[model samples]
Target chain A: MTIDDGPASDRVRLRRGANNGVYERQAVLDVLDAGLIAHVGVATDDGPIVIPMAYGRSDDSLYLHGSVANAALRAADGTDVCVTVTVIDGLIIGRSPFHNSMQYRSVVVRGRARRLQDDAERVDALRRVSNHVVATWDQARPPTADELRRTMVIAVPLLEMSAKVRTGGPVDEPEDLDGRHWGGSVPITSTFGDAVPSPDLRPGVGVPSSVAALDGTAVHGLTTRP
Target chain B: MTIDDGPASDRVRLRRGANNGVYERQAVLDVLDAGLIAHVGVATDDGPIVIPMAYGRSDDSLYLHGSVANAALRAADGTDVCVTVTVIDGLIIGRSPFHNSMQYRSVVVRGRARRLQDDAERVDALRRVSNHVVATWDQARPPTADELRRTMVIAVPLLEMSAKVRTGGPVDEPEDLDGRHWGGSVPITSTFGDAVPSPDLRPGVGVPSSVAALDGTAVHGLTTRP
Candidate 1:
């Protein structure tokens, strides 16, 4: 696995639109920390499989957890996997349909995933993954002993990874610049809607500060927060 | 490859939360047609790689187009690939952080992707991919012969596919139901913002009717639309 501060290997290298690929460590981490959901891929006897799962980043490793019965975890345990997170920032509408594209920031991490067998490691990884979603683990009830036993957490170190970003407006063809066509981007913002309180909540238990902070926040990216 | 009506192969089968897997053809197609972006995964020499890109659905096959120079297209051509599309509906806030999860609809399609070399087939597939984003290709300039030659379109049949969806609120444990924690869903909505017309647009060329129609449309799942 190629570490930070060097060019990526052929496998993780960007062959097309190389400019969009961000290789610096800080840039790659920014993309990873921003996204809550990651699409993890693993090879199987039949073929490769990809599925969306929640994850948390701790230092140089990304942690993913599920029940012991989860098929993705079972297949990915001690095996190579690819974890990808994509945040669609906007839609690129071009003068010609051929040139139309998406404005997005995506991070791809390729490495071996090892299912954490240590009890303490599993608990900490679960907390990390949970914190990314709610951000108020101290207020919420921590996982019980039995709950930890039923869960499976796997970690993929940030060894071979690259970040690809596309921003700004559409790049129309030279000839089409004068054509009668509208070309620009329609920004897509993902924000938390009105919070619906749980019916079973005890009286006076309003939305927690951690959950309330999500309001109007960008769905992906820690940097977007004020 | 497992056909539409039959049960999915074990490779594509759901084991963790089996009940979330939807095997019916119509249900799976609905999820695929809803999104413009798909995270595609393919095995490589170093490991599996996943990247997000645009896609189009025509009948039983899913089409993905990119430049001939694109690395993903080159690797996926004539090889098995996993195309996963996920639409996040809301964040499930549970009584205990352990039970907290996401409400999302995801479709996973696995099969060998073949690069369309036939000129006519390539042109049609490109149109399908483009139309999914803007929806009105007739008004936009069609790809010229030279543009067609420069693009590579790969088609993955929806033979081995399944849709896994989780909706409604979180189901907390009986003991935690009495806990003092705020819990409910924070709905997530993706809609197009105000259209920013291209600076090069000719006068009187306002936002097209097709683009305007996307003003309040949901990012994924066709059923969410009016």
Candidate 2:
């Protein structure tokens, strides 16, 4: 498939299924912001490593949060890294097994991740990360000074990024559509169950609004509200 | 954080959050089977790239399937690669944002992927992959010979692997527990939605038992049954 449109970077080019590739910056950012987890790829002496880590997006960069001692976090420093976030929407069951596929939206960002050395920047990054997971950042207790010192936050600029999405029902060949086989799509959604309050919570402290608002909401498509 | 009993390979060691790392083989396999998609890491000349791909597991290896033109599949051949599968179970909302975390089970496998050159092996791999996606592969139309030829399958052995998991309520400091903030865990579950029948399906062809069985089932936890 031809390079329809997107960042003209070699690293972000889609070599296969070009029709599903999305090059728009806003689209890529939307996928990044919607996802709370990213699998970060870092090259190491042993080989390449992919680790699942919590992340947040701000402006043109993605912030990855972890402990300073995390292997993947340490390996990503000064080296080119890939951060990929995927949200599976459904399973497309076609008439034939060959045509069966998944409905998903995935974003891949490649850049050098620089460690946030400034404590203020690092704390801000952590807040972003927290907000991404739970929309109630201000209501939740902020990290203490010592806690900020212990966490490692890496900022990867969204210089080269792409979003690939697959949706709708299975695309079966005309001949197979007439065959005696059923085909369809099963939607898969991420939902939150009942909130189990902490056993040691004080008697008067009730479930905060920020935490209660998460019920029945989509995990990735959390509302961007106050 | 001690290196609790697990494969002691240097590549599989947990460098951080040692308390959350699990070293058992069965535990790792459970997480692998419970995940429909994996973020695969491959080293390239430009840097490291991670891409989301569909995968199936056999006795001792993981099979990755994609079109022949997929770049990440081509790059993983004969090179060390990392495949990570993660299932988010819940959100650990701590009293402090710093302590907030996700309850997830993740498996990381590091090994060199070998391209399946043998047609028999390739077809078997494809069958396994299909079955992994839909348990009723026997009822669905099998892949034609040409279709089989156009697909690429890579086999990465389960050599150096580790599973990291976080479970239960948030662990807040004693002082924070008394603070006027609610803290707990919001369970996250991946559930399947209704199956929308294909518009072009023949009038006589109704939803098959295989397709109807998918309702209410977890996407990754589908039983390996007919």
Candidate 3:
């Protein structure tokens, strides 16, 4: 299949809790955009292993960079992979510990992840990933030819994916709701603190606009839930 | 293996970047204790998949609670599993886009995960899982007998595990250091927002002490780096 048009279409059907499945592609895209990392899974001879990696999403493709967990992508090497991103919305305290739950928005994308070989494609994918995290790829110094050649990036078609969300508050049994147990939700928030300048930064290099925009604002999906 | 001692001693060998491996058991334990969730990987008939799970660690075993992603644990019944947790500490802006990296600590625990059958073990494991997220299990209403019976829980021995850490700042090319590129790290933080009471909560119910501890202090590994 061509890189632009993948064979992925409707491969994800939740084994259970079917009602929580989100069919809208936009919902999947929203979670992908808000997440900082993707938990990448690949089958190996030994067993299935999951590793966290920084990733960026194109229209219908996910570009996974060869970063800290570079070994995970290199090992996948054009094999079936599942890329999942989870943004926890809040904690639901229920009348019973058994009813305690987390309000979260999660997406699972299943497809064969092919390592991009073309330098041009690799550069584009790398830029997407870099920009997705902090949105300064345009202003930052671009990757050199040698760097591009050395980087190992992979692309996963986003066509076969579904999102599962647990929103609102705890679902407690009627008898326990008004009892002694506290029944409510505690919200969780992730935010970028004030950008700290590098000790060795040039005398007058100001913080880039993209980094400047991260002044205690909320990270989507991970922050502020109703 | 007994519940107290897992067969996991050393199953993790970094496929690459061996220097970053932290072999200390305490290092692995510290990362696990500080983290809020585990990205669990399991092989399915279709392919390998990774799922985000809320997990807890006793002295040697990890207790995984069946929450939103219960399907994954059920599929992994009595199978080898890889549970990984990554806590991002900071974003490193480098002299070149290629050098951009994240400062973080992560642990990968691999073992045969078995679903717990004993009621006593299940109760203990579930309590550990609850307390790990927000240490209020003692105060929260305990699970009912039926709740215990219906809950699906799995235990992964922390015997075979390793911790990979990347701390400190960006490591730019020697020549690129003095160039125009900004080289520093933007620290990322995760904290519990104010406890938001559920709409129908009784007016006399005040925030619990365990949750009150969440007033803006840093989450261990996800916040602040030197």
Q: What is the C-alpha interface RMSD of model 2?
A: 1.4
Candidate 1 lDDT tens digits, A1-226 = 2234554655677767677778887788788877769999988776778889998877778999888888877899888999999889889888877788888888888888998989988877877887876676666777788888888899998878888888877888899877877788788878777777767767877788888887866676464221
Q: Residue by residue across B1-226, what tens digits does model 2's lDDT show?
A: 2335766487888767668888877667777878878899999998999998888888788999888878888988999999999988888888888788888888899998999999999888877777775675777877788888888999999878998888888889889988898888998878887789887878888776766877788765643422
Off by over 4 Å in 3: A1-11, A67-70, A221-226, B1-11, B67-69, B221-226
Give the range where candidate 1 chain A is weakest over 10 consecutive residues by summed lDDT. Answer: A1-10
Candidate 2 global CA lDDT score = 0.82
lDDT per residue as tens, model 3, B1-226: 0122332453477655566777677767888887777899999887888877788878879988774346678888889999999888778777688878787788888889899988889888888888777877877788888787778889998888887788666777788766776777777777777778877777788778877777676666332111
Assess each prediction's global lDDT (C-alpha) against the native: 0.80, 0.82, 0.77
DockQ (CA atoms), all models: 0.69, 0.79, 0.57
- Clash pairs, candidate 1, are A34-A221
> Candidate 1, residue A45: CA error in Å?
1.1
Q: Which pairs clash (backbone N, Cα, C closer than 3 Å) in model 2?
A: none
- Summing lDDT over every window of 10 consecutive residues in candidate 2 chain B, give the lowest-scoring window: B217-226
Summing lDDT over every window of 10 consecutive residues in candidate 3 chain A, give the lowest-scoring window: A1-10
Q: Write the per-residue lDDT of candidate 3 for residues A65-164, one digit (tens) a residue.
A: 7753466677787789999998876777776788787878788898888988787888888988887777778777878777776788899998888777
